[model samples]
Target: MTRTAAIIGGGVIGGGWAARFLLNGWDVKICDPDPEAQRKIGEVLANARRSLPGLSDVALPEEGTLSFHADLSEAVAGATWIQESVPERLELKHKVFAQIQAACAPEAVIGSSTSGFKPSELQQGAARPAQIVVAHPFNPVYLLPLVELVTAEQEVAERAAQILTGIGMLPLFLRKEIDAHVADRLLEAVWREALWLVKDGIATTEEIDNAIRYGFGLRWAQMGLFETYRIAGGEAGMKHFMAQFGPALKWPWTKLTDVPDFTDELVDLIAGQSDEQSGAHTIRELERIRDTNLVAILRALKGQGWGAGALLTDHDKRVRAATALAARAVDGVTPGEPILTQARAVPLDWTDYNGHMNEARYLDAFSMATDRFMEFIGCDADYIAAGGSYFTAETHIQYVDEVHAGARIEVKTQMLLGAGKKLQLFHWMYAGERLLATAEHFLLHVSLETRRPSEPGPEVAEGLRLVAEAQADMPYPEGAGRTIRRPG
Candidate 1:
């Protein structure tokens, strides 16, 4: 079914929500009274369009329709999912919720993107309290996957979670209402510590930030505090670590006695330090730097299948299943073979100092194409799970041209030859209309159990034979097999 999402605010958080829904193929209608709402959301969407899809090679759903409305009721008329992102004033929210409750369809689920408010508070005086759930998300909602769900009713929370998950977000449901919810509570604790560190002249804001970004942030990115502590416990785990560090908990390393008052003098001191620290970059430049670093870090984690990396893995699977790969010759005897097997956006991290794609990414693109080729020939996840698979024994690559980030790239795969346990294939990679590189791979069918080269089962072998025969008459790809020789 086509989905319609209504966003009730047009600020940073609201604009981000709009981007996530609109880009994920859900028709999005936004209601914001501000005259500049359209421009605000457009700017956010521009940044979102550039960053989010580049996280994975697979394509996102074709973008859905976007429209703005002057009236709240008209904006939300047919929406199945209504998200309220109005300002955080209690009276203002109560009024907004009442308006939303009156306008919302009975089947629609209304969510509030309030970081600090509990769902119960947001639903105060609402006609349908059960429909109002808190679905708070971080800034740049289009990229980050985590959404904290807090609601009075369990079933409503679960339903909201399902909807968020469909759009590639990880919904964390809170059983009971809390002032700040889980993540904010953790963030508050760190914030307090950082503030005290700054106020007491212990560390400057930049120095403290560097401490986190350089030292513990990387560990925290993949392994949360508890897990890292658990490992610190050594062979015995959490309990052992607790025993060793229990005494230090009372030490005066932290001055978390209380929050320092924001006196004018202190405020100026902090602001001055910030200006000197990062005054050269605009907000947008800083944002891009932050986002690029996040993409790189998350992509690294994805490689290891941990933390936010795991979220990317899940999103990529769903994306691949929904993407439009070229005509797949699954049975191998199909009439027209697939010319293009794998398509992906060039992620930001693939570029090096030269501003073009680095040398190694060409091989990575070809390798995924080879994976797709195996899928075409009937060796997919299920086949590999049953202990049948192919391993790349050797590869040769030719770099033809330079490609840059945000370029739409694809791999056109054709078989050179395949028989028995050995199969050779060629992949031509293109950035838009220009061929960027070519790769040749030699693969050996391997039985996972024996860990040795072996003949594939009946189905895959037949598939390979059909493909080989279909391409048998075609001339070999240029530079299929080559070696370097020096003048002797």
Candidate 2:
């Protein structure tokens, strides 16, 4: 069954929420009075379509439908998730919640995007107080995965977390709701100090930002604060670091409790400095730059399988598993046919200076297909762990056409030969009906214990026999067993 999400207000954050849900295959409904809501969400969706799918190796689910509704009831009708992103006002929120509860289902999750308001406050006059939860997400919500879920109800939190995780978000559940959730509180502290610094003429806005992006910001990106500080402690760890820095905490270095008055002069000074720092680019341009930089950082973290990157790696596995299940549901791996192995968009990093997928990535795609094929024949991770797996003895790739970033590609594998101790396959890669490349791989089953070629296990041998026998009568693939030769 398809899930539906109703976005209460279609501003930047709400639009981002819509894009995130829509891209993740959830139908979206927008309930906003603003006439520009459609255009605004369209731009956000454009950016999402360009960036979000590239985050995963497998293609994302087909984008869900989007529609606009003039009435709250119409929008909330049949919506499983309703996100409220109106301006932060308690009275206004209460009114919206009453209207939402009247129209939305009792079990539908009502997520408030208020940065500072607690769920309790939002649920004050609600018919179903348990349904209202604070699911505050960061800006550029389509790209950022963190969603602060504040709710006292365990059931509500679990349901929200499960839904958010399905859409590739990390829900930080806070049982005890505070005025400002965890991340914003940390940001507010830094904001206050930065304000004081500017007010005191100690550092300009640009200078303060420079201090972060060029210094501890990088460390915080991957390791975070305590771990970074623990590393700073050297061989002794957190205890040593705390002992050294503990005294300094009382030395009047920070004005944590004090705030600078928000005078017009101060506002002008900061805004002027910010304009001087980044006046050249439009907000959209800045957003794109931020997104690109974030993608690079996230991809790097994914490679290391640490921090947020680890989350991304796990999400990829989930996507792959879901794809496999869907494929199996459609047709059990039938014999005498080319098995659909890989279907995904070419990630941004796969391209090189030529602005097309680089040479090595072709082999990477084919290798992924090979792995999928191995799994189909019962030679999976567990099988390999039990000391038997396939090792490529030889591979030949023919690049017929160029593939660029964001192109949806599919790989289909034909089991040319699958016999005892040997597996031979031909893979054809395509973008729709356009054949882009072909790869032939000859692999031998090997014993992981001794790292030598060995006879196939019973389960695997039976699988190989089924496919090999079924496909034995199929015509030989074109260009099979060919060697590199001069054009003729």
Candidate 3:
């Protein structure tokens, strides 16, 4: 089904939520009091268009339409999910919740994107408060994988977790509702110690940050603090480390529990040090730097299969292909029509052993492009998820030319055969006017759950027939009878 999400508040975080959902192919309706909400969200969406595509190796699910509504009630009326990203004030949340409850369906999940507030506190004075859950996603919500889901009602939390998981986010369930959830609580502890270090002249702001990031941060990236320290114990593990360091807990070395006085001197000193370290960059420049670093770090962690590694694996899994021959998945083609995808330069990660784009990635890229073609013909998630999909059964690939790394290429797909149980497709990969590769594929419609040959659903079959009918008059490939090229 094409899910619909209503995003209330069109600021950075809210815009991020909209992009995440919309890029994942959910229809989005945004409502905010500010008249400039559309402009602000547009800017965010532009940046997201570039960033979100690269985050996943797979071609993104077809993006859903975006709508801006001035009326909050209208926005929530038909939305399946209501993501409240209003300002973090309790009163503001309560106010929005009241309106959302009045307008939204009772079964719809109401997600509050609050970083520090408990769901219980946010749900106060609500008519059907049990529907609300804290789905606190990290900053740059479109890119970050972690979303802390907390709710006193386990059902609500579970539902939210399932929904977020479907869209490719790691939802960590909180055992109990705390002020800042799990991630932020760890961050708060570090922040408190950082302030004390700065105040006591033990370390400057930048120095303490560097000490943590350059040292433990590297370990924390792959394995968390406890797990990393457990390895440090040399087979004794966490228990041994705790026993050895337990006595150090008595030292008055940390003012962790105590709050730092935010005096002007302290603020100025911290600000000056931060400025010296990194504040020279403009916000846009800083964002670009952050995105680049995130990409590189996540790429390095891909082998770890922990944290970002799992995420990268999931993203890559979405992009699939057959052995040596590039597999092409086709849908929505009238029996004789064609579908096309304009290619771009291969990203840095797609290159391989020869420093040129890898053979496997050509198939990967073609598969992604084919998915977008399916989406164009209405063979989207709901269509495939409902027990019907076109699986490639046979393929022949001819590499006519080589495309170097970073070279822009394009693909054109034509429907060659359409029968009751099988379909044949031909894809031509081109670099400008030169044909670089030609892929001939035979696909079978199958039940996703059963893994057995099956007829397409009524809607999918009808769309396929329409596309096939248009291409019925076209000629087959010239090399149709040649031996299939085995994958290298």
lDDT of candidate 2 over 1-488, digit per residue (tens): 79999999999999999999999999999999999889988999999899898889998999899999999999999999999999998999999999999999999999999999988889997899999999999989999999999999998889999999999999998869899999999999999999999999999998898788646685677546765555455555445556677566666889974455555575456445544655565555554555556667877878988766787888888887777523431134565678788999898888899999998999999999998888777787788999999999889999999999899999988887776787888999999999999999989999999999999788788767766665666777898779522112
If ranked by TM-score, best first, what sequence of candidates would result?
Answer: 1, 2, 3
Tens-place lDDT digits, model 3, residues 1-488? 88999999999999999989999999999999898999999988998898889878789899999999988898998898899999888998998999999999998999989999998899889999799989998878888888988877877777888889988899998889989988998898888888877887898976876676545675566546654544444444444555566556566777763545555565456445544554455445544544445555666667667654576677665653322112223423334545665456666667666877678877876776566555554567888866677787787777777778568788877766655556666788888898888777777778889999887666666656676776768776666536644222
Off by over 4 Å in 1: 257-488
**Tens digit per residue, CA lDDT, model 1, 268-384:** 564455446545655455546656876889788799887667868898888877765533455334334435777888999999999989999888888889988888787888989
lDDT for 92 (candidate 1):
95
Q: For candidate 3, what is the TM-score?
A: 0.55
Give me the displacement of residue 261 in model 1, in angstroms: 28
Residue 141 alpha-carbon offset, candidate 2, angstroms:
0.4
| Predicted structure with the largest lDDT when compared to the true one | 2
**In model 3, where do residues sit more than 4 Å from their true spots?**
257-488
**What lDDT does the true structure give each of the candidates?**
0.82, 0.85, 0.75
lDDT for model 2: 0.85
Between which residue pairs do clashes occur in model 1?
A: none
CA shift at 258, candidate 1, in angstroms?
A: 9.8
> Which candidate has the highest TM-score of all?
1
